[model samples]
Target: MISIKRFSELSYKEAVVLWNEGFKYYFSNMTMTVDAFIRKLANEGLSPEHSVVAYVDHVAVGFAINGFREMDGKKIAWNGGTGIKPEFRGQGIGKVLIEACLDVYREQGVDLALLEAVAQNERAIALYKKMGYEVFEELVFLQQNGAMTIDAFHTNSNFEIVRGIPEDIQLLEFFQPIKAWQVQVPGCKGAESIIVKKGNEVLAYAVYQRMMDEKHNIQTIALNQCEIKESIDVQKVADFILYHVFQPHHKIKRMVRNLSKNNRLVYNTLLAAGFETLVEQVHMSNRLDQPIKESIQ
Candidate 1:
């Protein structure tokens, strides 16, 4: 009575309903309207044709959103999200969905498949391990609200911040291989970008996206990437970016995602500047050395 099919086969309403039901009682609220769901799919590069939906007796019971990007000349795939309806948990449905995703990655000639799971989600992490994923990095999410008072400016510093597009920001040397998949150039596409420069030399860069409510009021400011040049104090550069990024909007919620543990300066600085740790996640990856065939249960 169980089967899996391409997500493209379902209507947007069906997919969003399944998404909300699957994420019921999740760590964070994931409720989404049809319009929000469409925006997320387009922003995250998730495609219905590349994603999968699970069915039990012909009703949607679970779903996965997948995306593909070329990185460093290799095709990389990401499991943007995987969800199973609350009632379907512990039924081994997650395993089936993951296997389906890997099969799709292999078929697409992806050299790597990546995903992140909430650190507290032990069961999901264990399942990913069983599926050949290895924890390569630990990531942190930070957020702040109300008023940000930290001085993001330095009188001794001669850096000038320049606003640019994501493409221009990504070309900076600070954007390196260590970034998480969701913060990479592909993920930052269509986002606002800023770069700090001292004359012709680039010191750091940041990329963030703004989401507005129906009233056109800024609701959230999500920082996707922040890269500081080597040999410079990371915290200082981060402060500079934060000060300018949030100064114009005092009432909006500010957030930064996927700061790797290996990069502690920026991470620690954010916390010191009043941002609280929202959650931590483990970044896991599975390398596809050979083709894998889908075996739906």
Candidate 2:
């Protein structure tokens, strides 16, 4: 027989074990220390109260972490992470974990829920589809080795660059539409924004998060009120950012902006900047036509 328990009921060691098991299943060489996992959970607000652990005969076999936040005035929930022990496969544990997460969302007044699964994870994808989840976007995870130089690109007479600050949170709030998931990471600091200003007008802006790995992650970028006259040329901007921000490091890896299937300009920009897709994940959501309006911009 199987039982589901709140994450709070388990000790920290048990939670870490479940987390490591799930990560290793997807990435064979993954070895996240307990400290790192704990930090991530705390950062993402994945406490035992919001998470679920499954056990069989008093042994933990699977677990799921969930998080919720307000976006665009609507409550949103995310399946932060989940995994089942290898020996417990084909026993419907994944389904149970997912259902438990959805139940939490429903009780929390979350109108929408979201998750990402590797594109090749057919079993998980099928299960999600069967549970009323639909594909909203496809995310490409890209990475690169060594340092690269960014070049300054000349654009036609239209926009100028302006530095942004946290005070511009209201303006940045405009980006809730294209963001994948929303959560606050207070310890994850050092965010900078650059606006493409047309004289006194602010057209588009990009927000980047500085990572400890000496790489800058493009958390979100958006153009508002007006469409970009010319493609903002992502390659030049990325190169410029890296050259100005990243120093010589053993390796540099950052998560780039999310791209829709039809967005070719940004795609080409990442590719031109030497970012090769390491993996592809399918973004599944329970809300199809919901409005999102928080800007990481």
Return the TM-score for each candidate structure.
0.87, 0.77
Residues 1-297 of candidate 2 have per-residue lDDT tens digits of 888899888777867777777666574355567798777776665556878888899988888888776665777677877788888988998898888887777777877777877788899899989877888777665555555443322223434667665235335423334345421322223566555645665445455565442354432222111112233554444333333333323345445534443445555555665667776887888863345442222
Off by over 4 Å in 1: 150-155, 210-220, 232-235, 248-252, 290-297
lDDT of 1 by residue, 1-297 (tens): 678899999899988898899899998898999999998888778879989988889888998899888766677788988999998899999999998888888789888788999999999999999999989889999888865663533224546978988778646665665357678777676688889877788888878888889998878888887767765555566667767666633777889889887667677767777788888999988878544332100
* CA lDDT of every candidate: 0.80, 0.61
Quote the lDDT for 233 in model 2: 51
Model 2 score (lDDT): 0.61
Residue 73 lDDT, candidate 1, scale 0-100: 69
The 10 consecutive residues of candidate 1 with the worst lDDT sum are: 288-297
Candidate 2 local Cα displacement, residue 186, angstroms = 7.6
Q: How close is candidate 2 to the true structure, as a TM-score?
A: 0.77
The best candidate in terms of TM-score: 1
